[model samples]
Target: MALATCATVAGGMADFLVARAMGRMGGGARLPPRVRDMCARLGRPLRERTFSCVLVLRLLPVGSAMMLSIAAGLAGARAAGFIAATLLGSLPQTVVFVLVGGGTEVNHQWQVALAVVLFVISGLGGVWLLRASRIARADRTT
Candidate 1:
């Protein structure tokens, strides 16, 4: 179990790093034209509140850091800025997951509670990001 936990955590970190790097490289440019067009249409709103929304989303585990990085990059934020913000915002929650996984289970309730909290937080962050993405796409159009 411990080994699995460690591997999972390490894999998560690696995936996040890979995503961030790819995002910085402009992953969005490779998107289908239709998707790009949609994003472009709603780019304006995202531009208006990109920083706050991105920061919050990055802090939540609902979205992966790499995915977030791609989003921020596609939204017109600087790659370095987005990467830095994502790292900072995600550190706490990522630590929580890693720490939790390091130990064995005593009671299932605690695990359930943690899962619930993470789910709630991630859900809220997702809504915020969705709104922000729409805004960002709109901004690009104008």
Candidate 2:
């Protein structure tokens, strides 16, 4: 659990920092000027609420980890916020993995059941967050 949570957090932070530096150097070089401008405008709120945004995204488990890390960095998320969110958000998933990996045959059923419950909850919450984010984005655009 410690390895999964802490080590992975370190990896994510590294990815984030590297991506951020890359973003600073020339992240939008290939994008058309119009698209770059639009991305900058849309990234405002994410930059403002970096912790909450990153935390929710880390918890969701829907996208590529590399992409999320890159996006967070490119959007100029705070270092502390990104680290804290990644650490906290990885806990539940680490719990499920630890339980499954260590449990005995007799103990495994309940652990598996708990894992399923957690997964279902995560899925539903991801859907809710996605809808809310879309609505918020729409409202902002309008």
Local distance difference test scores for all models? 0.54, 0.70
Alpha carbon lDDT at 2, candidate 1: 45
- Model 1 segments beyond 4 Å from truth? 1-29, 33-50, 60-64, 105-142
Candidate 2, which segments miss by more than 4 Å at Cα? 27-42, 103-107, 129-142
lDDT of 1 by residue, 99-124 (tens): 46643567555655675576567667
Error of 1 at 21 (Å): 10
Q: How far does residue 3 in candidate 2 sit from its true spot (Å)?
A: 1.9
Q: Which candidate tops lDDT?
A: 2
Listed per model in order, the count of residue pairs whose N, CA or C atoms clash below 3 Å is 17, 0
lDDT accuracy of residue 126 in candidate 2: 61
lDDT of 1 at 79: 43
Best-fitting candidate, scored by TM-score: 2
**TM-scores for candidates 1 onward, in order:** 0.47, 0.76
